[model samples]
Target: MTVALMWEARAVAGRGADLLAWARAQHLAGTPLRRETFRAPQDRVLVITWWDAAYDADLPELPEPDGTLVGRPVHRWRFEAVD
Candidate 1:
């Protein structure tokens, strides 16, 4: 089964673009089958990556962007397809 990993972060006031740029340059250890990014209200950036790995497998994730650019620590979640 394939799993999707979601990572999200909120940029500091007026720094959303910088945060997005930083995320775009990230390089995870494994190549994802698919990847996407979104911009949300309140200066948030959401990144979802599809990988051919188990939900519980240890995988390399993007490191947090510089503290000055984010309002808080990054959040992450893992999900397996149900359909």
Candidate 2:
């Protein structure tokens, strides 16, 4: 099965660039099949990772950024691919 994990976070005021840089620097213990990073208005950052594993399988995820850099807790979700 194919699973896609989504992680999103919002940065504090005037810190969008810093947040984006921090997210890009993170490294997971295991490499995903595919990975991509995105930024949006309101200083939001998103990271999506695709993995060749079961929906419930244990997988590595990006850690939370420093409190000073983010405005709120990160949001995350996982989805299983379907034809």
TM-score for each candidate, following the candidate numbering: 0.94, 0.98
RMSD of each: 0.8, 0.4
lDDT of 1 by residue, 1-83 (tens): 78989999999999989889999889888899999999988889999999888889887787888899999999999999887
lDDT of 2: 0.97
Given candidate 1, what's the lDDT at residue 75?
A: 100
Query: In candidate 1, which residue pairs clash?
Result: none
Cα RMSD (Å) between model 2 and the true structure? 0.4
After superposition, the stretches of candidate 1 with alpha carbons farther than 4 Å from their true spots are none
Task: Count clashes in each candidate, considering only residues at least 3 apart in sequence or on different chains.
Answer: 0, 0
- Candidates in order have lDDT scores of 0.90, 0.97
Error of 2 at 80 (Å): 0.5
* Model 1 / residue 52 / CA error / Å: 1.0
Q: Give the least accurate 10-residue stretch of model 1, judged by summed lDDT.
A: 53-62
